[model samples]
Target: MTGWARSPLKSAAAWALPYWTRGEPGRETPSDLFRVLYLGWAVALTLKVLGSSWDVSWHFKWLRDDLAPPHLINTVGTVIVVALTIVHGYTGYGVDRTALRLIQVGTGVFLVAVPLDLINHRVNGLDITSWSPSHMLLYIGTALMIGGVIRGWFVGAPEGRTRTVMLGALFLFCLENTWFPSQHQEYGVFGIHAWDRGEPYAEPILLQFAADQMGRSVDRNMVVAFSLPAPDYLYPVYATAVCMLVLVLARLMIGRAWSATLIAAGYVAYRVLIWPLLMVADFPISAVPFFLLGAAVCVDLAFYIKVPVLRAVVGAALVTAGSYLSLNLQHTLLDSPPLANTSAIAAGGLLLAVWLGGEWFVQRYRLRGQPTGARVSATATP
Candidate 1:
């Protein structure tokens, strides 16, 4: 009886694997169908970043609406992924079941949170930070899903144009996630004064405290609470730490010259491409973080100068220091009121510490397995 019961269970699991993994009714190696489907998924995810940014901007600029353009863009992007998942089940080309199943779990969580977000907006209103429960869940989901896709490519992409192009896509996606918080923060700081006059959205209690501190009555609409200069180090410190994580991981995996440059170029391209578009659309704005190119160059050069552990340390320090000094100086010299003082030494130290911890973990996991980038050099990338 036990043997008969176990046999069916094993059969069921084996039958289900291909729907979530590779090997389908078509059964082609990196099948064209698979690639096309993945391409669609990647496009959706890329749009998600843009849509998410627009959504946040919408919150800052206008009243919260469930079906707002920003929300619709983001939601439809996610829905596309969900739809693709269903279509893949029918079409026999799933999105890298080869990677962590945790990503699927994340997507499920994100779907559940979608409706909850409407409830959140209705009750609490739009938020500026990623700390809110719904927002955090959303971030966690996309990050996991993107990460799984990257992992799947690393495991599956062949050595040729396919690998190169997909590698660039992965780098761009990683850099987008790494630098997005900084972009959002920049928009918040500048737009607070420009597009929406120090707008009050959420956290009235905090605004009330600011009002009390100023010896004035708290008016709900008046943005008197947010006019003060934000802490200059918050964005840089967090951004640098996250940047170190992604940069080090990608460099380790790819181990190629100009790996950091690839990410930097993608970031710069997006800013340049989108800045004009936003301008044409009459959206409020300021200059991009063009200084990141200098910072990314420093990290890339450092990777060439040193070996594994030392290079990691040096790259982390260089990236953080270069970004802090270059971007902060540009902001201070160009913008009104200027940004608050950035703690270069502290940010660098923080990134260096985080990178070192990550290095130890990588070694523990044996992830440095004989330089995949060297095997990959035969294939060139843009």
Candidate 2:
């Protein structure tokens, strides 16, 4: 019984020893190292959700409405994200090279199909639409690529079919939300308008209704008799909620401390450096609030991951100063008073208090049964 129990342990050690010392193909190799990169992908996905303000839809709307070419800054940002996905996906494919080939081909197909479909639609005299099958395919392909890479790292194997199917389903759901009218429809709430100009078809009816209540102009945005419900209330809310839930699940899976810290830092860098550069070129004034929110979330998450004491202190100081400067710059650029300056200051203060409180709690908790910091330090050392 003892011999049997020890056998597997000995075998594992034997397998690991050669790989570590001789650099042979064993349980650990270059492939293994690449697999570990999935943690970065997880972090990127998390920050992508938290940082993005669903304003990309507006960007797309502007592109279509204005008949302008794609913004170079946005194109560059998209290219970077796409490159990361491809690298992450390739590493994932390394796990099960042969099996994943077919899956990769399918993924590539979907990615290409989306843009082609959009082009075809435009060529057929339909309006160049932002929300379409192609866009769904692109998003789904990216998600699948990220998800498969992460799962592959853990399982040490490919999850081709499952990843593909799951992504396809997600794509369909997103499509439904994109195409469907929102549920919040109130008919006759805003009075109807006449088809011809200078006609008061239902003006009296609306005015009478308004006078009986409070005397406000009836909502003019409503169409002839029926108007599409606001998609804002449901689509974005549902999409964000589900994305956050998925992020929480992914966080549970990748629980290493150092990896989390690196991921947080990478995300912080991306949001602070990349997102604003792209968005600000077009909508300079309104971009401030969005950028600040992204910066705050990134900094907070980075702090939570707990870097070395000196590094953490330096990072915190830089983030605080940068945030303050950014807020003031925003106010100056936009020609308005600082809106969220107080809240930002309060949040920074709160973060400092939490860090100090946590340190005290840890020291006190350890000192209850041991010789203060010395014994705790000794125990913590490798």
Candidate 3:
């Protein structure tokens, strides 16, 4: 007889007890279970990233459909994430209490956002902008969920090739999530360019709706408004202050000399690879963030400075300069969005402030004789 047929409660307790015991907070999990759990996490996150990427491109090409293929793919990823979250909660394998709590909270938020987002769509005509509040909640939840997974894997996995590879992959996903919202401007650049060439990519209906919302006729002016909705400053600000900060964190967490560069390169490469694929699938494409790699390199170099405050200042300066130069080059070569110098300076200042604040917090944390970062755990033998 199956374990359940013998006695439901007893069998359940028996099965759960070992997992609970084996996976107590800060305790190493069995090798097999560790691999299994984190591998599942990797797969689920990959699906979500892929789905979300396709979904954005899909939106640019067609009208919103609840049962669109991209949405279906994203739903499948969500289902897998829900299953993984349940397993993590029940067994506590591969995650500490803090990590588990983050995962739970994030998943809860994402689930709640789903129905709310649908309601938003029903009411708001077309939630075309990725910067909408409801959509941001989804991104926030995903960031939280991914952040938890990054912590769990960082702390629980023993130092080895496996850990390095897994952490790098996770950071790449994190970078992707961090940079996702900027894709609107990325897509918009090419979108307007295409329209100027008398070959707009968005469907006529989508263009009409977008124009209608702004009380304008469906013309070049409407397309310009629809395509480049956000101000130019927002893009560079996000690129310098927000996204590059993620690279800095990845460098610190991975504790690798080139971790930030590799992760940024991987993200850029993924975008490039997907560019042609999306076009072949008859979807809209966006300008890839080639400048990210240059900024990432500067971030890695800054980490070598040893002194926290000085490191932050120098790093922010380097990244700001490099990113501005790179953005200008891209604009010249590929007709990408030009980086405003004023915006770059503002973003750099913001980055420096945040970095200094982080250093202060870490110093305080150190003074308190508490662990500053994730706790390293030993791996248990099977």
Candidate 4:
């Protein structure tokens, strides 16, 4: 046998026993095992992200098919996730008990959600909105699953470039999912504009179905309702309240100087890369949230504040102001909607509250007089 083949065989044979033995819970995993296991998770999640990106665009152009190519791509990722769950469950190698339970429950919830989603579609015929209850369940399950993986990787993987890179990548996926629902409006604006200009982006069947749901004919009004169902205020508020929150958490979790900026940049870059590809494929494209980079920069800067409470307060304000400006800039330059004054104020106040609450939780959770950085580092690889 070749030395290359022999080496892997030897490692696998050696790995088998401890894997089956289910060694002590929360036990320290070997660095090599940790790398391989978490890297698999990273790849699996990347596949899921790509599939979801395509799935959203696909829905805009075609009716929901049970066996669509995007669904098949997602299914492949789910299969890998299931296999990894089994390995983690049996081996206790890469995860502690709590992490294992999270993975198991998340996987179970996701599995259950799949059938429910199909049933939802069967009953409601062509429910394409990603904000539907069934779809939310899927997103929730995915969040839980990603949370478990994050916990596992954060605790298990030794501190290094590998750990930093993996954690950052995971945050990017999380941010994307967090911002996903907003795409409805982002795409809708463009779709409506295109329809007005003599070229409609949606297929006739899709427009017909949506119109039928509202007892209306396929016209401009129907198109407006079908495409831009959400209120304009929601987009910016969500950007601050939900998506920016994720970036804040990423900054905390990744524990790097520019982690938030890098992650946000990565997300925007991915969107730009796919935008042309989707256009070439004749699928609908949405407005990319370039403003996230501004907020992300603020998130990173927020950490430099020495006092936690003041930091959260000032940081929230900064993110809100910076992002609002960026949103306006994007609206002027891109096909995005104008930012509302009410949304900016509401977003700032809400973000401040959440940021303060998060700070209190961090302070209370730590041992007496323990430095905040120490507490943060305990959950993250520095």
**lDDT tens digits by residue: candidate 2, 192-289:** 22223443333344334433333344444423212222332332232222322232222223332333223334433543464466446542112223
The list of candidate 1 runs beyond 4 A from truth reads 1-30, 85-98, 192-230, 333-342, 357-382
Residues 1-382, candidate 1, lDDT per residue (tens digit)? 6999999999866864554653332233334545655687788887787886566545545555677787778777888878765654444343334333545666777788877866886666444455457866776676677765665455445556666667667767767765665565656555555525544343456455545545677653334233323455666666666765676666656656777767777777787787677657656454576666767777777767555678767877788777767776767665422343456677778778777776776566444422242221212111
Candidate closest to the true structure, highest TM-score: 4
Q: lDDT of candidate 1 vs native? A: 0.61
- Screening candidate 2 with a backbone cut-off below 3 angstroms (N, C-alpha, C), the clashing residue pairs are 114-134
TM-score of each: 0.75, 0.35, 0.89, 0.89
Model 1 worst lDDT run, 10 consecutive residues: 373-382
- List model 4 lDDT by residue over 194-219, tens digit each: 89998998888888888888899999
Tally clashing residue pairs in candidate 1: 0
Q: What is the alpha-carbon lDDT for the whole of candidate 3?
A: 0.80
On the 0 to 100 scale, the lDDT of residue 72 in model 3 is 88
What local distance difference test score does each model get?
0.61, 0.36, 0.80, 0.80
Clashes of each: 0, 1, 0, 0
Error of 4 at 182 (Å): 1.5
